[model samples]
Target: MSDKPKIKVLVVDDEQDIVDLLKYNLEKEGYEVATANDGIKAVKVAAKFIPDVILLDIMMPHQDGVETCRQIREIPETKKAFVIFLTARSEEYSEVAAFDVGADDYITKPIKPRALMSRISALFRRESKKEQENVQVRIKDLIIDKTSYTIDKNGKILTLPKKEFELLYFLAKNPNMVFSRDELLQNIWGADVFVLARTVDVHIRKVREKIGEDYITTVKGVGYKFD
Candidate 1:
C-alpha cells in the first residue's frame, strides 16, 4: 500500500490474439500482465502470480469460464482476485451465468481498445478506492466482511466480487429500504454511471443464488430489497 504496486494481471483465454492484444494494451498502461490459455492453467498461474485482477474468457478447451471460476473460488489464494469475464456471449442467460460465477464485470468480445481502456480504468479507479474501504455488513442471515471481502450466509462463506459485494452491501446496509434501479445505479455504481438495468438484475439474481432463491424480493415495477 505504500505506492501503486505493480498491477499484476492474469488473462485466460483460448484465443492467442485476445491475450496478446490485452497484454499489449494493459502493458501500454503500465500493468504487469500474464496470460493463460485455459481454465486449468489459469488456476496455476493465478496462484503463482496472485494477480491484482483477472480477465477471464468463458469458453476454452478443457474447462470453461464457469468451471474455471469455480476452481478459482476454491483456491484461497485466488479467492479474492477481481475477475472480469471477456467473452462473445451476449445472451441474457449467459450474462446471468457470468455474474453467478463471481465476475466483477462482463465485457463482450470484438472489444474496442478505447472503451476497454475506459472500463479498465474504471475498475482500476474502483480498486484504488477499495484500498481504504471496509468490507463488512451484517444482514439477518447474510453477513458480509469487506475487509476479507467475503460474505457469509448462515455462517457459510459466499464468494463474491468487488461490484457484486458492493451491491449486496448497499442493499444490506439499508434493509427494507426499497431502491430503484436508478437509485441503485447512483448509490452503488455512482450517480453518473450508465449500465443496463439487466446488469442490476443479474447481480441481484446472483446474490439470490448464492444465498437462496427468494432471499431478495423483486419490486416488480420498482427495484429490489432483502427479504
Candidate 2:
C-alpha cells in the first residue's frame, strides 16, 4: 500500500477513447483525473474541480483549446493552472499558436503515457520552486508582488504565470533597457531550457494582456522593454 497526495489532472478532448485512455493511464500512475469533451466544458470542469494541471486538445467541437486557455487565464481559480496542449497538429505554426495562447508545453497526440507523465512531472517540479518568489516591481499603476506572485493593476489583482512574472521582474529590474529574446530565454527561462525564442513572445503577450495592452514594449527585431 502506498500513500501520497494524488495530483489532480484534467484531460479535455472530444474523442471518447482518447479521454478514457488518458484517464486510465494517469490513474495508473497514481494521479487523480477528470475529463471534458469540449473547450467551454473544459473550463467549467476545471473551475469546479480545480485540477493541478490541464491537458487540453487544441481542436475540439466547441470553442477550441486556444480560446479556452485565454479564458482560463481570466479565472482566478485556474489562472495559474499548468496547461499543456495535446493535439494532432504537427506544424511549427501550430506549436507557436499553442504557446501564444498560453500553454506551458505542447505534446502531439497519440500520446505516450510515460512521456506525458515525464513532461508533467518536470513542469510540476519547476513550478514548485517558482511559487516561492517575492515580487514588488512598481510600474506606474501596476504592482507585482514576487512572494505572492500576483499582479495588481490600479488595485485589481492580475493573474500571471510564475514564468511571466520573472520575465516582467527582470525587465522591470532594468526598466527601459532592452533584452534580446535569446538573452531573455537564458536569464528568465534558464539557459538549459531548449525553448524557442518565440516562447518569450508568447509569455510577454500574455503578460501584456493581463497588465495592459501597452505594458510591454517590443523592439521589433530586437527584444522587449518595460518603458
Candidate 3:
C-alpha cells in the first residue's frame, strides 16, 4: 500500500441507502468514508472526522444543508473542507444558496456513483496541482497566502472560505489583468466542474466584502481585475 494517507470523505444524506451506497463505492476506491443521516449528525461527525471532503444534502431534518454548511465553515477544523451539495433541488436559487454558503460543487441528485466519483477525483486532482504551485501574493498591506489559505490586511488576519480565497489569490497573482466571469469560473472552479457564471460574481462580491474593495476592481462591461 502507498504510504500516502487515504482521502477522508464524509457523506451526509437523509437517505440511508444513498449513504451506504456512497460509503461502499468510496471504500472500494480506497477512501476513508464517514456517514451521517441528518444535518445535525453531519455537523457532529464532521467536527471529529475533519474529512477533506463533505458530500451534503440540501434538505434534512433539524438543520438544512445550507445552515449546516455555514456552521461547518465556521468550525476551524472543517473550514477548509470541500463541501459538495448532493441534493434533488435544481432551482437556480438553490444552487445560488449552496454557493453562498461556501459549497465548492453542487450536483442535483439521483446520484450516479461513477460521475460523482469522477467529480470527487477531479476536485482532489485540482487541489493536488494547486498545492504544487502554492505561493503568497503580497499587495501593499494585504497579504494573500495560498499556503495557509489566509489573508492578512493591516496586521489583522482573516480567513475566507476556500473558493473566495482562491478567487482573491488568483486575481492578486495576475495583478491588473482583466478576467471575464467565464474565464474566472473556468480557472477557479475548473473545466471539469460545472459552475454557473453568476457563481463567479457571487464569489467576487464575497471576497470584496471580506478584504474590502480596494484590491479588486470591476471593469464596466468587461470583467474584474486586481489593481
For residue 214, give model 3's deviation from the true position in Å.
1.6
Sorted on TM-score, highest at the top, how do the candidates line up? 3, 1, 2
**Model 2 lDDT per residue over 126-162, tens place:** 6676556444778777787776667788888875665
**In terms of TM-score, how similar is model 1 to the real structure?**
0.78
Global CA lDDT computed for model 3:
0.90
TM-scores of the candidates are 0.78, 0.78, 0.96
Superior candidate under lDDT, 1 versus 3: 3
What TM-score does structure 3 among the candidates reach?
A: 0.96
Residue-pair clashes per candidate? 3, 7, 0
lDDT computed for candidate 1: 0.78
For model 2, the run of ten residues with the poorest summed lDDT = 186-195
Which residue runs does candidate 3 get wrong by more than 4 Å? none
Local distance difference test, each candidate: 0.78, 0.81, 0.90
* Model 1 ranges off by over 4 Å: 1-3, 130-135, 138-143, 151-164, 185-217
- Cα lDDT tens digits for candidate 1, 1-227: 45868778898989999899989989998789999999999988888888878889998999899888877866777777777788898777766677566666778888776787677677667667756765577768777887777887787777676567778887877788888988876665553344567778877876777677755788889889876
